[model samples]
Target: MLHAYVLYGVAGLMLVVRGIETEQRDSRGGASWNEVITDIGNERWTDYYIRCLHPDVIRPLIRGDLPKRLQDPEFRQRVSASLNLHATPGVYLCQFHQTGHLQPGDSQETADTLEQRRGAGLTLRQWLMVVDDCRLYSDVNNPASRNLAEQIDSAYRTTRATNYASNQRRWQSGTRQQNFAGLEEFLNMMDRRWLNWARAQLGTPNEWILDVPMVRAPAVVGQSKNVTERASHHLALSGSSYVHSLISCIVKFRFAYRFDRSVWQLARVERPDHMNLCEAIFSILASAYTWELGLNQTVSGASHQAGSHALTASALNQIYQQNRDENLRLGNVDKSLMLDEQLVQRIKEIKAFDKIKDQKFAELDEREKRVVEKGRKMDTAFEALMAREMSGLIRLQHRQALEASRAAPA
Candidate 1:
């Protein structure tokens, strides 16, 4: 009975592992070894071999020169999903001869095969070596292989830089910045757009930000009186909602400046031509900051006058010290501010602000705690909003693509 039970348990484990493997293969659009080879054919032996050797070895190739058959709308989508699954390390490798990163082995068969195929023979090991080569020597020699290779490299570098800068800017902007979530979403969208724009711009008419206005001016803003129509036109041209949002923000700020003197002055919206999108965004932020301060001051003032409650000097000091400590921990030394000194200075400012505000709430009250809690809630909401906005923007771009197809010349 004991032996039977052990055997059954081992069988069950095998079944489970087999099931998981099957599921993964299905999800990745993977075919049986025999099926993959047959599908590729002997004439395309190099393609089959590279893919069989390691899944990732085919990615750069596919992305660079997607097989004509695979370019079918449905097929391309499925292949893209499959390619994404090869993100794991050691799962794929490039041929040593292809990437020129690793020295070729002494096997005559491998070397001859590689030479015949023009450095296309790849094993699973070679796929990994290729990725390492791409990552390490990406900046090396500019080989004139194909236009696609250059475009992919250029786009990848631009995307990486844009992502880094956008993340850094978002961190600096903090939770207090007006429409922080919207702005973050916009930044992410802009990164994707800029990458696409860069790829399209390369050796083309649509080459830069300034080129967009010059080449596609009518499409940029649209001539429609209807708001939805105008927005749709802009969406089709820009290929992104962030661009639409930017344009909308600029137009709205300009209109607002026409009537509201106070808003105009605070925003510094002097001339229509001078009103850039970044400037408009900063104006909105300034307005939001003013509103927040006013609301906080009112609440603080009421609590002090009523003598209901107040934060203790110790708790206030603790909060200030914590902010300072956080700033220090971020270590902006190259930024010219010693962590400790910056923290101390910020703490001092907060302490001074608290002293002035504490007159109304000398006893430390629920009101002050509510204010702090509100700030935390705002920060959380901002993060969530940004995520939602990004998803929405991607969806909007897809929708625009569909619309443009429907309206295409028959």
Candidate 2:
């Protein structure tokens, strides 16, 4: 009797394993294993958005064709109001049509206009914050529009005052003569570093061409020996300012481009190359902004330098953290685990068992949460490893420089 009981126990264990395998196989029926594998390997929210906006295999769904459930009337109203779409419907429509996205048009011209507007807005907001962070625009007697207009006026005055001072210093020194050279230097540095960093992050060298030229003031008035010198100066200053403004706008445009590219890459279920590119660009921008704020402090001779510095630092830190979180959320591991017949069979079996039992035991929510957490941890670890690698490279470069210096008998 004891021998018979042992044989029955072994048989029961074998049956249980077989049943589980059978259940898995049933659940995965009718599903494309290749697609499942791709989804698992390329986990990214941007990928969904990219496909929705610019699909390849299936022509992109038109905006009008989007499901009603996805279109929130209230959100659309808010966006319309904030963007002043009512006043510029045609312009916005043309922009959207050209860019192939529903988002506000970010064409080169539009970007310049937006930057000018943004600068105006930022100046007004900063002034209001100084007056009263909470109730700066709460006066019933003063129209909000009028208040904003006044703030912008004050800000421009302040900017002009600072610019005039700088111009005076340039005139006093021989530096004014070299303004064109300085502009060239600035443009060269921006172009070289921006392209290099962009290429590194994209992992596709030579994909883009940096064709924008260094801006310079127009030749002196009547230096042409034909026109009035005063008029020429006016034209030169205006032209130079326009060029500077456009370049600044391009910087913002590049930010938006990378954002869109990241989404596209995700949609195509490509590698994490774009994420790396986004991170690198964000880092460079943060570093540049920090340096600019420091220079602002030295030039302004202001007591609130520390506070401004902290604000700028916080903004950069926030951007970096946000990018890191996004990268973590989008990254996928176990990509090597392809969607083969075995995996498909296993999934099918699980689904069939759940259906037969009339009670879900797969615990999909729990499983998904565990997977996401694992991916986040893996991303963080990878970032840390890269940071260490960069540090090592820097040290090696420093050592090489030191050896060269010693050998040169400085």
Writing each residue's lDDT as its tens digit, candidate 1 over 1-410 gives: 22422343222222332344355446655334223223222222121122121222223222233344244667445333322212211111101112112244547765553343332222222222323332222222324322323433333332222322232211223232331333343333333433333445456532322221110011111111222222212321211222233333233232222111111111123432343332222232222222211211111122322322233435434544543443345452232211233334434654665685676576467677888899999999999999999999999999999999999999
The residue-by-residue lDDT of candidate 2 on 118-222, one tens digit each, is: 211112112122223112222223455235434432333323222232322212233433433333433333334233333353434322211111111111110
TM-score per candidate, chains pooled: 0.14, 0.17
TM-score between candidate 2 and the true structure: 0.17
Best by lDDT: 1
Model 2 Cα shift for residue 196 (angstroms): 2.6
Question: Alpha carbon lDDT of residue 337, candidate 1?
Answer: 18
Model 2 spans with C-alpha error above 4 angstroms: 1-179, 199-410
